[model samples]
Target: GDARGAGRPTGERSGRPTGDARGAGRPGEARRDSGYRGTGNPAADRYAAKKSGAGKPRQKPSGPRAFGGERFGKDLGPVRRPKAARTSRPADELDMHNPDGVRLQKVMASAGVASRRVCEEMILDGRVEVDGTIVRELGVRVVPSEVSIHVDGMRLQLNEDLKYYVFNKPRGVISTMEDPEGRPSIGNFLKNKNKNERLFHVGRLDAETEGLLLLTNDGELTNRLTHPSYEVPKTYYVQVRGPMGPGIGAQMKEGIELEDGISKVDSFKLIDSTPGHILVEVVLHSGKNRVVRRLFDAVGHPVERLVRTQIGPIRLNDQRQGSIRVLGRQEVGHLLASVGL
Candidate 1:
């Protein structure tokens, strides 16, 4: 007999033990030792036990996870946040139904007393009276042609038939229609042209200064054109007493501080140069009295002569001095449109 199968049962070398070696040895000893419970063959029994997991340990059951204090698989509908509050005023507080009339300050400003802002301040200070009653409230509306407005006890009238004219004002003639000293006035030009209408000059040129001067009976148009808000540009040909330095034009354009306010020029350029004198063209929008002369005076070079060549869209091209001419319909329309009428 072979040594490996010395103590085994018969037919063990052929991979099949006899009946007693398979299950007839002990009570539960054959099942555990042979690794096969129901099969009679020992090799067959070992193969069945390995595939069925007969010796493996079992795992324990676990619970589901928690999300926001609720079960992970449960539904929670939609999430919402609160709305913010509004900050604007209520609709009832606004004056939606405004009456149809021009503002009191606007009418006063158009009458040439002062600017709109200054007129408003004047009204609030009780210096203005409408139809014999004091009007201190703002936004008080009235038809200027229908109502009688007085400032400091002097009544104002609105001329309906608006007339516009351009005059080449000569030197040494007063800008006013009548001068208290009985000097040569603009009225002489109007009389020569046979124009008998009462007109006020838009802005004044000093007796010594000469050039284009606008005469109009339209108070509203006059105010609009002269007001600083409109920014109506005026061009002048100036002759200064000394030779201008290289940067004098830049200095003028930059700005100059005067007693009344800060004056600024839109542009300045040299037109001609002579011995001890320089002629330059300057453009500005200021309606202040003697602004052109004052600006040159502020600099070291005083103005020897000043002539306004243009006002807004109107120009004094080839117009003879001391002559007056009525503005055409197209020119009048253009002037009004330039200043927002």
Candidate 2:
């Protein structure tokens, strides 16, 4: 009987069960069914069939419909993004419209009253007067020949004939024009020439370290040449106490922090080496006091003797020690051009 049921057509078994199999249906139902048990009323049977999903299993959506096309409860549409702000024009692109006459502080600084920054401070403090009127405002431009500038009740005398000189500063000679200790100074070398004009040294070399020194009456050029902002390279020949190790040059070139600030050598080259001493040529733009000596001392190799061989375009090749000579027009021009003067 089980073999016969298995071989029977699916329609015959699906319709109704016979005899004892009919007992599987509920008491009120007329037939046993695989899905929803049908009621006698046609409308009720149709409702039951619809509620039970009488035919095939429900299928999911195929592609995009699986994910509802909505974001944060709103229908997704074209995305709106913000635009970037426009940038300002570069400095070079701006119009080149400069006012006439020299800046007030600049003129005062050029007259050897003080450095540019100090002159600005003086102006701000109401210590500077122009044309008999107290002018504290910066950026006030005036012609040197026309205006009367006074600092601390003393009138400034603008030096029309600015002179530039290269002096081979000798050892034991101070770098200043005057010293309270009555030490031999650069003024001793400049006495014969420009007797009345006051000149200032561009940079300083210690009394024991002798080399090329620039003396100028042009305070503006002095400020530009010596100011760290210009980064004018100064070359020096340094003799240390012992032979420099192989990695010393690399270390110096990298940089070292000192008490004042970090110091870095732009270029370092080992000139000669011996068991007793090491000679090195170092180029740097720093204008710190005793910077070269401090750098060597920091590396455990104290500098025995140091000499500045070059400053920007100027060189102290064969200039006799204790001798001073006026810089040629071409040399002066080159030096000025080096600092964008």
The lDDT of model 1 is 0.75
Model 1 agreement with the true structure over 1-341: per-residue lDDT tens digits: 56877876675655555545554444554243434444555566657866775544544433332222323342743333232343433323323212577788887777667889999878767788776767766667776766767676555544447777899988999988888999999887676444567788988889999999999888888889888899999999999877666777787788889899888789998898889888989999988889888888998888888899999889999998888887765466567768854
Quote the RMSD, in angstroms, for model 1.
23.0
lDDT of 2 at 25: 35
Per-candidate TM-scores read 0.52, 0.53
Q: Name the 10 consecutive residues with the lowest summed lDDT in model 2.
A: 89-98
lDDT of 2 by residue, 1-341 (tens): 57766866554454454445433434554432445554545567656766666544558864444554323324665434333343433323322212477888898877767789999888777787766767656657777877766676666655458798889888899888878999998777776546587888988999999899998888888999989899999999999877556788888889998998889899999898888988999999999999999998999998888999899989989899888888865476568767865
TM-score, cand. 2 vs. native: 0.53
Best by lDDT: 2
Per candidate, the number of residue pairs that clash is 0, 0
Q: Lowest lDDT 10-mer window, candidate 1?
A: 62-71
